[model samples]
Target chain A: MACETDKALLQENIEEYIKDDNKVVTCKWLSLMHSIDINVAKRALHIFVHHQRNKGGNDDINVTFFVAGLGKSKDGDLMHKCAVVPETELEVVKRSLATVTSCHIFSVQKAKLKDYTPLYMTDYEVIKDNIDKCNRFSSIKCPWVSLKSGLSASKSAQQDVVKVVLSENKGHAFSNKTETGNDSPGSKTRALAKKVEPKGSITSMFASASKKDGGGNESSKPVQKTDAASKIKATKKKGGVTAFFEKKGDSPLKQKDVLLGKDSKKMDASSERFESNVTNEKKQDPKRKKKQAADADEEAPDKKRRRRIKTDLFDSSDDEDVEAGEPEEPEEEIEEMEQFEVLDKGIEEEHKMTEEEQKEEVDDSSLTKSAVVGKKRKRTKKVVSKHYEDEEGFMVTKKETVWESETDEEDEASVNKQEKKSHQSNTSEDMGKLATKNTKAKADPKGKAAAKKNSSPQKSKQTSLMSFFKKK
Target chain B: MFEARLVQGSLWKKLLDSIKDLLNEAIFDCSSTGITLQAMDSSHVSLVSISMNSDGFDTYRCDRNLSMGIHLPSLSKIMKCAGNDDIITMKATDDADTVSLVFESPNNEKVSDYEMKLIDLDTEHLGIPETEYSCVVKMPSAEFQRICRDLSQLGDSVVIACTKEGVKFSASGELGTGNIKLCQSASTDKEEESVVVDMNEAVCLTFALRYLNFFAKATPLSTQVQLSMSKDVPLVVEYKISELGFLRFYLAPKIEDNDGDN
Candidate 1:
């Protein structure tokens, strides 16, 4: 694709080119016209003319493609997931897809270097979507010489600097040959797997796995496990299970409503009346169970007390100690609780959640649904955020996703949740075990006061809990 | 690679700071060989964690695993001895009480190593945790610092009164009271700091001359400071360091009438 028209003539169609409103491409098209990867133009034409069934537009495919993709993409935002700053070492090519789209060139200095304009946002999706069409590039006015003059890359990576003729994915620095070679029709649609990635790496295998097994499929669990195992093996040489996450976010939102959190457009705020209703559920349920509990209270109230305290990680440790299951059993549990507090302090300081806070989630399904009501608009936060990840850690500000991700912070949260929950139910399941211990202290009415004296130091327990939850 | 759980005393920093009984040092317990000490400075409120774990080292050798107990004075001295470009090397042998710190500069020109022995200091510190407050406002730290800096120009004593609306930092001299409202804030061409505030909670507390004078230290660390208050609760100064941690200061709010309205 080369400039056949004057710069003045093409300036007339700048508004039309900018109409697509893709934040990344709109910014990069200007750079491509003057200094695009010669292969980028050639490949884009190959895809648009051949794969997209616009084959006859070889005349216009060269012109309008860059304008539609890069021109419009930059106009919105130069959202780049992450940039490969000059000093990235040990970053794996097999697992990582290193894409440098027309968008990531935030500010391309012209021949003068002083005057510049913003370029395309080079995230995987934005580039993948618009670059498939080439007729769009025909509209742009290339101030630089034609494609024949631009194919200057000695190696593919140099395409970042040189303006290449054919806009192919070749020399694109990202994508293995086979992956990039799929500009074919059936293959083009088949390869949309890189759009939404799980496991956080920009790898082809992981990306394809996410595409095949995403959207709350129970099958995703195994895929996730396999991906996680592979990732752990890849990341930690000679690795065992380095990380495990038990994701139990607020019990408030129902499973269906939880899915709505990802579907930003589907959120309905009018249903928030359910939040106040759930908060009242506990009080209401007690009333419903009042008569049954009142009769049971006459005889130890054992079942009610056990049922009520079963879910609490803290209370279970106390119960285990009195049972004499082991002499020094509670010490380990106490230590785990203590470590939890330090973790909480760190998360609280960062405005995130410790696993402890997540573990105590009591049917938060209603609370989340209420939180996501009319307040929920059709926002593409994840998409925009993906663009900027190249600068910051690709942080998605979808509050719900972030809140959910918080539970799996280091997989420690999930481990503690299981350790605490199962320990609580251990004593209640077998009273025969507690009854076997015969070392009963001499019975005295003063036992209550003595217990209080011994437990005075344990008051730090509350503070520990606060530190764990980062109680404000 | 190694996560050592230290089951020690729980002393809440926020609670302890209320009565001026906060610990002088941060005692981080870590087992030797497979561990990480990733700390971001409290001054830069946005978090930057510095993590160097067992895997991070190419050749990590530890004969025995021991719990780490670092004191404040030792840390300060080490920071003073180390230069910016110095490669810091810490080595402690098995059963060794002291860890050696060596600084190797460029080209075998100079290398310095020093060992500081571990001292037994009581970890438990008594702190008064109770305090009541009047008001609290979470404002951007940049704006708060600007107000403090701008008002400090008028006089040394800045009477910071708060309302449900916003915080007012006013100082008077022979001229008049210099007031600044950080609530409804804007930026000019020269300045580019704008924050959308959800500041429904507000507090009006008057700080003493020297207190606001010294508070000049906190603003640079964080972008936002949540100023918490109660009539009796010491005013809480909170700032978030990006993603790392929060550094907070709790000051006893001075009621002017208590000192005969001086």
Candidate 2:
């Protein structure tokens, strides 16, 4: 092969060429260009031309490949040339470069080019994709220059300084173009739109890319698209390529929706419903505040919205934030119940005297109240709360006749719920009260004393249970 | 009658300091070899066994093999009364219910004696069989203590994996996964300072960090700590007290439920 002849000729002047003069090509420099065995530098020189393939251009331009040497300035163009034998393949060049760089070929990667991203050039795929760039030198500009056993290495070192300044200038200009491109309104709008759209568009883009890369294999297409889309999304969001493979599937929309559905089926249904109840408990006033009555009506619909949020495919981050915010809900209900208990105790003491005198004085003044106990836990709470809203209306009218001057700071909302609860307990307590009242009526004619003992403690248990659920 | 005197009372004080956080009481079995204490914590998740040889003590005397059940907190309270260099003498009758601790200060400057009542505790003595551990890693006690302390803040449990390369302590939780790897250090001037791993085969086990933190109390007693582990068996963390015997801690592994997938 032609490469073999070129490799042998380069090996002859390996030591002289490696001298620190402008021609000294170290393995460190060559490893950046291509993956090569660093050990090869110990044996021979590796010289090859890099054919620059300008995107949208057919002509392949010759670019001097400087492994670790100074470039000679000629006509304002910085070009590095070295004397070497001919017919070397890119592989031989990479092996020779690896020897100088002292880096394994598998670890090398091409620097980020204008068109393509910085890719792992260690594999055959990267080499095959950029085959045009791996061409052998067509002609040596400085053919007469020869590096013998003894030569001054200082000549090459001086030339490298000029090449370094030129490269820095080029890098600055290239970065400026990219900054302007990103700043354009058109580009900004497109990026923003991509964020707004669900993952459906990204999935299609991934499908197309996979189809082009992997050919007609449809079975593995979904998996590959998921990997690619997730990789892109993770990198975009995290601003680092390292986050690409951090998760199994991190596509923002489809995967999250799927996750939400599964989470909803598992725990979302109860947790979401729990959130609404908490929100109601927090906002609801124990006093008969008009706003509290309005909030109760709105709470019925909020529960449906919570259930809807669970069934509908949606993002969970927002849902999680709401859940964390309402942890104080349970504490509020306990506070409201305490205030209502104080009012109920005062009412019991006032009614205690009248009940003792008229043993059958079942005060029918509270009969018009909605104390209808419905079947099941849910309906019972709904019927009781609804009755409280109605009782508040009657409580306003009957306040003067019954417990006068007790209006301010009294939580009628809680009082209404407690009143319904106490009423329910009274009916149960009524059964016990009747039996006891009959014994007291026969034994000592003090039926009111026995009735008070049975009703008071049972009413407290009922109030505690009411606060425990706080069912809106 | 049973009496054992420790020349360095500070060491025994640290031994009690390490366990008082987890266990309230323990039985001290006085045997001819020395004094051995083996007991489990309240949850029965961890077992701590301490044995001191008769040769290790300055003066040791036991007429008969006796077991004295004592509350650890009360004993630790008495231990705190003794100065670092004080001579601690533990005396209890074979059939008596209370134990007296005599603390003789350095140069006999001041001496204080405390008699703490002992309870009759009916605790089953578990005979731990000899386990052929797959991996044994010897490392600096301070390093082990620091790793356990730091990683406990990250998770409730830690996974200890031992291989030919090194021993790794890994914890994964809401924050993320953290791993501390200690490779066998190259032989230096002090061999004890270097981490050494001896493996018959690789073994990986998960244990609760809560117990590990409790066991790390023995860090002050020994310079080096050894971790012996086998698959599905409790991991043993042993700290060998020079001239004395060793303090060994055994903790049950948290088994992964395959069917329940917990």
Chain B TM-score against the true chain B, each candidate: 0.53, 0.97
Q: Model 2 misses residue A318 by how many Å?
A: 23
Report the TM-score measured on chain A for model 1: 0.19
lDDT of 2 by residue, B1-262 (tens): 8999987888889889988887899999998789999887777768888999999999999999999898999999999999999999999988889999999997998889999999888887677877788998899899999999998776667889999999999886655678999888947568678899889999877877878998998899898999999887788899987888899988888766454323
* Candidate 2's TM-score: 0.40
> How far does residue A60 in candidate 1 sit from its true spot (Å)?
99
Instruction: Report residue B192 deviation for candidate 2 (angstroms).
Output: 2.3
DockQ of each: 0.02, 0.01
lDDT of each: 0.35, 0.51
lDDT of 1 by residue, A395-439 (tens): 222111111111122212221211211222333423332222111
Candidate 1 chain A lDDT trough over 10 residues, lowest sum? A379-388
